[model samples]
Target: MNKSAHWIIYVAMLLAVLTVTVIVSLSVGEISIPFKDIFDIMADKESMEYGILAYIRIPRTLLGFAIGGSLSLAGAILQGIYRNPLVEPYTLGISGGASLGVTFAIVTGLHLLNIMFLPLAGFVGSFTTIFLVYTLSLRKGVLSVNRMLLTGVMISFIASSMMMFLMSITAVENIHGIVFWTMGSLNESNTTMIVSMIAIALISLVISYLFATPLNALRLGENKARHLGINSNITIRILFIITSLLTGVCIAVAGIIGFVGLVIPHITRLWVGSDYRILLITSFLSGSVFLIFCDIVARTIISPNELPIGVITGLIGGIAFIILLSGSRKNSRII
Candidate 1:
C-alpha cells in the first residue's frame, strides 16, 4: 500500500475506536444503560433514562471530546513550534492561570452568584497569561520561543503559588471547591458551553491542518525553514496564538485536566511518525478516546463515588508515557 492508503487506514481505525469509546462513555455510568437501549433511551424524552442520557451523559461526552482533542492538538502544535518533546499545552501556564482564576472566584464567592462566572474567570486568566507570554517574548519584533517557554514556566509557578495562598486563607468548603475543580470534572451540563467547545475544537483542528507543511518545515529548525522559503516567524506566531487560545478555552471549560495535552501527542507521534498531516488527527482521536475512557473509569471505578477525571488521566497517561519512554530508550529517543 502507498503512504496515503496507510494514513487513511490509520485514521479510519482511530475513528472506529473513537466511535466505540463514545458509545461506552454514554452507556457506562452510575446507571449502566445497555448499548442497544442508548439511542432508544435518548429518544424517549419523557423517561428518566432520557433525562440522564440527554442532559448528563451526552453533553458530558461531547465536552470531553472537545476538551480532549483541543488539548492534544494544542500540545502537538506547541511541540512543533518549540521543537521540544517535553513541552505540553499546560507548559505555557494556561492551566495555572485558569486554576488561579477559578480559585479566586471560589474564594471571593463570585462563583456563587452565577454559574458562568467560573468559566469566564478562567478564560480571562488564561488569556492574560497568553498576553503576558506573547508580550514578554517579543524581542525587536521577533517571537522568542526560548523566552516564551521560560517565562511561561515562571508564570505557571507564580500562579500556582498564588492559588495555594488563596486555598490557604479560604474557608474549608471553599477549599474543597477549589481542590475539586483543580482535579477537573466533566459534570458541566451546559449545552451551550459544550457546543461551543465542540465548535472551537473542530474549527481549531481544521485551522491547524492548514499549517501542516510549515510545521513539518519547522522540524528542520527555524533558520533552515526560512532558508527553505517557509516564513517560520509568521507561522510560529500564528500557531502560538491559535493553540494558546484553544488551550485557554479547553482549560476554562473543563478545569485543569492534565496529561491529555502532554501525553497524547507524544504517543500519537510515535505511532504515526512525525508527519503533521497524520499526527494531528491521530493525536486528536487518541486523546478523545483516552479521555472518554478515563471519564468512564472515573465515574464507574468507585461506583457511586466518582473519582476526578484528572486523577485518572494523570495516573494512566503518566504510566503509559513512562512505558513508552523506557522502550524508546533502547533507541534513545525521549519523544
Candidate 2:
C-alpha cells in the first residue's frame, strides 16, 4: 500500500484503540462501574457513579494521555535535533532534575501548602537543569551533541545523589512520599492539573509541529541544514526550550515517568518513517495509547493496591529498548 493510504488506516486504527482504551479505563477502576453505567453517569451528573466518573477516572485518564503524548513528542524532537535515536528526556537528565525538585519539596514540606506546589518546584528544577546543560554544552557558538550528552549524564548523577541525600535526611514518614513521586503516579489527578497539562501539551505540540521542516533538515546534519537556510543553532535553541517546557510540565504533573519519551518515538518512527510532521502526530497518538494501556495494567494487576505508572512503563520500555538496540546492532553488522 502507498504510504499515505497506510497512514490513514493506521491513524483510524489508533483512534479506535484510543476510544476503547478510554472506555475500559473508566469502567474498570476501583468500583468497577459497568460500561453502560459509565455512559449513564456521564449523561446525568445526578447518577451515583457521577463523582467517580467525573472526579476520578476522567481526569486521571486525560492526564495520563496528555503526559504520555507530551513526553513522546519531546523525545521525538530531541532525537531529531541531536541526531541520536537514544536521546530522551529521562536519559538527558531532565527527569532527574524534576525528581530532585519533588524530593526537595517533600523534604522542605512545601507539599503541605498545596498539591500544585510540587509541580511548580519540578518545573523550576527542570528548567534550571535545561539551562545549565545547554550553557555547559555550548562551545565556540556551537551546541556540541557529545558535550550536551556528557553534561546531561553528569548532571543526572549529581541530581540523583542530591535526591538520595534528601531521602536519608528526611523523616522516615516523608520518605515514602518522595520515593512515590520519583516513581510516578496519576492517582492525584484533578481538573486543574489536567487542564494545565492539556494546555501545555497542546501548545508545545503545535509549536514543535510548526518546526517539523527545520527538524527534518537538522536530521540531515547541521551544515546541510544551514545550507538549506535553516539556522541550526537557533533551531536547536528553540527545540531545547520547547522540549524543556514539555518535559517540565509532564514531570510536574506525573512525576518522573520514564521510557515513554525514549520508547514511543522509536516505535512510531518504525511505523511512520522519519518525517517529523507525520512522526510527531503518530508518536503522540501511539504514546497516549501505550501509556493508557500500561496504566490499566498497572492499576489492575494488583487489584486495589495500585502500582506506580512509572514502574510499568520502565519495565516494559526498558525491555523494548534493549530489544531494539540488539536488532540495530545486528542490522549494522549485516550492512
Candidate 3:
C-alpha cells in the first residue's frame, strides 16, 4: 500500500481505539454502568446513574483525553525540536513550575478560599517559568534551543528546590495536599475548565499540523533545514510556546500526571516512525487511549479506594518503555 493509505489506516485504527477508550472510561468507575445503560442514563437525567455518569465520569473522561493528548503532543514536538528521544514536556521545567505553584497555594492556604486558586496558581507559575526560560535563552535577538534546554533544566531544579523549602516550612496537613497534587488527579468538576481543556487540546492539535513540514525538516537538523529554505528558529519558537502553553494547561487542569508526555510519544514513534505528520495525530490518539485506560485502572483497581493516576502511568510507562527499548536494541532497531 502507499504510505498515505497506510497512514490513513493507522489513524482510523487509533480513532476506533479512542472511541472505545471514551466509552470504557465513562462506563468504569465506583459502580459499573453497562455500555447499553449509559445512553439511556444520559437521557434520564433524574436517575442516580445519570448524576454519577454526568457529574463524575464524563468530566473526568474528557479531561483525561485532553490532558493526555496535549501532553503527548507537546512531548512529540519537543523531541522533534531538540532531536532527542528523551526530551519530554517536563524537561522544559513546566511541571516543576506548576508544582511549585500548587505547593505555594497549599502552604499559604489560598486553595482553601477556593479550589480554582490551585489551577490558577499552577498556570501562573508555569507561564512565569516559560517567560523566565524564554527571556534568559534570548541572546542577540535569537532564541537558543540548546541554551533554553539547559536553562529549563536549571530552572526546573530551582523550582523543585523552592517547592521543597516551602514543604519543609508548611503544616503536615498542607504537605499532604501538596504531595497529592504533585502525584496528580483528575478529580476536577468544573465544567468550564474541562471544556476549556478540551478546546485547547484540540486547537493545539490543529495548530501543530501547520508546523508538520517544518518539524520534519527539523529532523534533518536546523542548518540543513535552513539550507532548504525553512526558517528553523521561528518554527521552533512558535512550537515551543504552543507546547509550553498546552502543557501548562494540562498541568493546571490535572495536577502532575507524568509519563503521558514522555512515554506516549516515544511509544508512538516506535510504532509509526518519526514523521511528524503521522506522529502528531497518532501520539495524540494513543496518548488519549493510554491515559484514559490508566485512569480507568486507577479508579477501579482497588475498588472504592483509588490509586493516583501518576502512579499508574509511572509504573506502566516506565516498565513498558524499558521493555520496548530493550527489545528494540536486541533487534538492532532504534527509537
Cα RMSD (angstroms) for every candidate in the order listed: 1.2, 2.0, 1.4
| Clash pairs detected, candidate 2 | none
The lDDT leader among the candidates is 3
Q: List TM-scores for all candidates, in order.
A: 0.97, 0.95, 0.96
Ranking by TM-score: 1, 3, 2
* Candidate 1 deviation (Cα RMSD): 1.2
Q: Write the per-residue lDDT of candidate 1 for residues 1-335, one digit (tens) a residue.
A: 89999999999999999999999988888888888997787678899988989888998888888888889999999999999988887888888888999999999999999979998889899999999989999999999988999999999999999998998888998998888988998889887888889999999999999999999999999999999999999999999999989988887888889989889999888778899999999989888888888999999999899999999999999998788777746323746
- Candidate 2 per-residue lDDT, tens place, 1-335, comes to 88788778877888898889888888886789888766667889887689888888888889878988899999999999888888998778888888898889989999899977988999888988998898999899888888999999999999999999999998999999988888888776567778988888888889988899999998789999999999999999889878987888888888888999889998888767888878888888888888888888899999889999999999999998777767866433311
The local distance difference test score of model 3 is 0.90
Which candidate ranks first by TM-score, i.e. highest? 1
The list of candidate 2 runs beyond 4 A from truth reads: 328-335
Alpha carbon lDDT at 88, candidate 1: 88
For model 2 the TM-score comes to 0.95
Clashes of 2: 0
Instruction: Give the alpha-carbon lDDT of every model.
Output: 0.90, 0.86, 0.90
